[model samples]
Target: MNQILPLELPNGISLEIKREDLLHPFISGNKFRKLKYNLLQAKSEGLETVLTFGGAYSNHISAVAYAGKEQGFKTIGVIRGDELGDKITENPTLKFAQDCGMQFEFVSREAYRLKTEPDFIAKLKDKFGSFYLVPEGGTNEYAIKGCEEILTDKDANFDFVCCAVGTGGTISGIINSALPHQKVLGFPALKGDFLKDEIRKFATNQNWELVTDYHFGGYGKVNEELVQFINQFYQQTQIPLDPIYTGKMVFGVIDLIQKNWFLDNAKILMIHTGGLQGIQGMNTILKSKNKTLIEVQ
Candidate 1:
């Protein structure tokens, strides 16, 4: 954990960020947390293969691929776009996963929506044989359990705990383990109130709320302002943030602070849930669009 002192702010308001991104080089931050017990469970079940879902540039896909490779499990990624099948070399995340020996099962976006359906799963089982399944975004009871350990006893001093919300597992774990005096604030990377219900299913308390205004359009959507902010934030903080999630959360937190949304004398702790691996892929997209790229460390 480190205090952020570069940004001038209101008196008595201090900001600190947990460098969960440094937890691992590839399987970093919340992905590590989300997969900790999941891999263990798979091992205990004697499962030799792991299957999961993600989009073209999904951080989860990359993390699971590397993790499975490192842990000696065969990995399969159900990618959302069939067209991305031949474009692996152009997409860093997918290419990295492919290099890690993750087999790709590309499907149309519409068919990907049926991932949770029994028929879809049955088809996958028929094609790939038996395997352990992980949900998209890597959220589940085991994921929440791993994420609960993210905050240490020393973290209890902060008045607010902030983290980027994706699939709600990370924040749900934070909510369950937060100190009585600390409020957990989640900045959702995707649009919709649907996450509220999804979070409620796992979170045990009412001390957390999702901030929806800073999504920058929705998941995988970013504008010039967001891109520029991400670049400047890295320049100032020397901490690279993925535009899809962490960058938006940090932007929202700073904006809220400037607007006096936090109480006077509040100490805020932001969880740096890692998705940095996706920056290369995002930069590739930005280059094609003539947009600014996120700074790399």
Candidate 2:
């Protein structure tokens, strides 16, 4: 539970990465905060199983699998995609998952969205026998409680706090902790203008703004510039960022800084929401010439 680990920026700004991603190899990153409330509700209900949804590279699904394994609960991930992919090879998140002995169930994208269906839950209950369902990102009341624990006892010198807003849990928690004088900014990873409405529907905030410009090509989509930024960021700072969620947020943060959005000496702590495992597919998609480009004879 070590919080507020500090690092300094090149421009004489003192910053911290808020080592939440180091919390657990499996339950790593902000996903833990989002899942905390749902986990408690499951225990209170005497449920021995937990089910959740996510895409092929969902940070939420990975977190749930790890949490269930660590807590000794039967974990099932309702993955959205065609039922394919090698589960044997460990991608980072799944490696810890396999270690914890979590189970997975693959469903088509259509079925995964019916997460709230009575028949769907009933089917899961029939198969798994009395389990709790954690919504996609595990963002709920307990997530807020877990996130509320994040900003405790930090340096009082910070001008503002910034983070990637996916499910709105982390930003909401920061908003709760910020004083009336402080400002909370969320750079969204979701595509289009629909995310603002989704933010309005789920989050407990009226002041937070969603910066839609930096999400790259939408959730889980990236391009050359983002890849270069990650490479440069790692070479310079030794910090690796996952492209889909946290990577874009980091890029957005840096851009905002360069534009003088924050005060010259403002202290901004960027949360490194861990998706290190998803790098597999991202690398697969990226075709930098430096990576071994042998000409076919």
Candidate 3:
């Protein structure tokens, strides 16, 4: 079982860490929460295989691959990136997926975009045999149900709850589970306010809203400010946050607090959706620039 550590922030804001990083070997982090229900639902329905979508280095893909192997379910990942079958080196995500016996299928950007289409999902089954298809970010009803467990386990009262909004599953779950008195804030990594509706597309009720303007740059974009935030956050919490998902969300949360968005002494629970391996490349890219990334916070 993972630990939920309580944190006392410098500004008098309090929160609890789900410590999902301690979940298991490969099936770790919020990924477990995000994937648990879909897998269970598939099992309940007697589906023998799981099919999902992701990029070359998607944490979702990594989790699905490892979980599928451990649970003895056939798994296929529709990957969107440069073809890797001929490459000698693979990103940690891809390498882990391969190690877990996940079958990989490459799709062009055009075809990959249509995977969510009913016709496209049907075609996938016709081509690859029978499978239970999950959306790219696992944004299905079952995924939301899995994520909702995070809130159910908490008995202590918190004024607010926060998490990175990728496919909005976790936020949707949190919103669904949070009572009317609790506030749910989602820091979306994407630009624009479009995700507010996208989040509601899942299961969020009146208790939630996506903070759309905090993406430091944009979806998948990072800068020195975020680098500084990640370094300082790691130094203070000993939690390694990748720039892609968790780092941006953390940065947004800190900014929200600093900006007085939260009541001065409000208690909040900021979830760390683990994707630390995604930073390996960013670290390499920054190291090549010959500057040590440090947080001044």
Off by over 4 Å in 1: none
Residue-by-residue lDDT tens digits, candidate 1, 167-233 = 9999999999998888999999999999999999999999988899999989999999998998888
Of the two candidates 1 and 3, the one with more favorable lDDT, higher being better, is 1
Summing lDDT over every window of 10 consecutive residues in candidate 3, give the lowest-scoring window. Answer: 1-10
Please report, in order, the local distance difference test score of every candidate based on alpha carbons. Answer: 0.93, 0.70, 0.76
Candidate 3: C-alpha lDDT: 0.76
State in Å the error of residue 56, model 3: 1.3
TM-scores vs. true structure, each candidate: 0.98, 0.85, 0.88
- List the lowest-lDDT window of 10 residues for candidate 1: 2-11
Better of 2 and 3 by lDDT: 3
Query: Candidate 3 — which residues are off by over 4 angstroms?
Result: 1-11, 153-155, 284-297
Candidate with the greatest lDDT versus the true structure: 1
RMSD of 2: 4.6
lDDT of 2 by residue, 1-297 (tens): 323433344465555666677767766678877777778888999999887777666677777877787777888776666553465353445454556665767677788778778998888778877678787877777777777666666534566667788877777777776655556677788777766665555456565677788988777767778877877776666666777777788889878767767776677777777767677656654544344211111
Winner by TM-score between candidate 3 and candidate 1: 1
